[model samples]
Target: MADRATMERIWEAHTAGEFVAQDVEATMDDDPIVVHVPTAMGGSGYDGVKDFYARWFIGRNPDDFTVRSISRTVGDDSLVDEMIVSFTHDIEVPWVLPGLAPTGQQVRIPVIAVVDFRGPRVRSERIYWDQTAVLARRRSC
Candidate 1:
């Protein structure tokens, strides 16, 4: 089971736009590692995860986003979290939808994540969220 402290740190770090490679690594398995993401933003693995951010956040100003609240359910080696993520698309980012111009919009979306941990690391994760809302907002701008 992942401790609350660790989870808190994860939330804080994510919100700070500081992508801790170790944190990402702690949430995956050894074989065919995968991170199942919600709609709008599909899933990926280790390098893929990093790549996703590179294309998504890194493409823009990392300061535009923040990760919050990582509520977790502990079950032996599994840790499930419903995290609250808040961000503003004030800067130009890569892969972001066109016409979905950045209105400097700030949004808070709840995402559910299920992760299997190997010791202090994560083995695999599946994240779910409301993609339509995200798209609607992006499009509205």
Candidate 2:
């Protein structure tokens, strides 16, 4: 039962950072799909998505995590946001780098999130980032 304000809240609150299951169930469509394309992370449908968030995304960021918006494009049914996400590699980020130990390095990665809506509730979302850029800093020249 989302309205315009809830939609706005979903955009501002969820994508700008992250959220918990209650926040998700209230703002997301009954059958929502979310994909982190670069690493093939994320999940399909409500339950799957909730599980994905619980296991990987939610509460996973380091204490120094931050996100800065670069730009955004809004449409009637969708929005695309460009952001610079920064954090200390003090936690194992399975969504971004699977099976890799934290190197204790500072990470700043550009992220693009494309989100679609069914009426006012979120229908789907796809996140993209450069895996090479994330890995390159650790490589020895």
Highest-scoring model, TM-score = 2
In model 2, the Cα lDDT at residue 7 comes to 58
Clashing pairs in 2: none
Q: Write the per-residue lDDT of candidate 1 for residues 1-141, one digit (tens) a residue.
A: 556556445434433442434233333334323433543443355666666555564435436455565666766566577778677777654333324556677767787767555555555556677767878877776
**Per-residue error at 46 for model 2, in Å?**
0.8
Model 2 spans > 4 angstroms off: 1-8, 16-22
Clashes of 2: 0
Which candidate ranks first by lDDT, i.e. highest? 2
Tens digits of lDDT, candidate 2, 18-106:
73232566667899999999899889988999898889888787788887889987776788889998988888888887777888888
* Candidate 2 structure, TM-score to reference: 0.87
Residue 127, candidate 1: how far off, in angstroms?
A: 1.4
| Residue 55 Cα positional deviation in candidate 1, in Å, after optimal superposition | 4.3
Q: What's the lDDT of the predicted structure labeled candidate 1?
A: 0.55
Q: How well does each candidate superpose onto the true structure, as a TM-score?
A: 0.63, 0.87
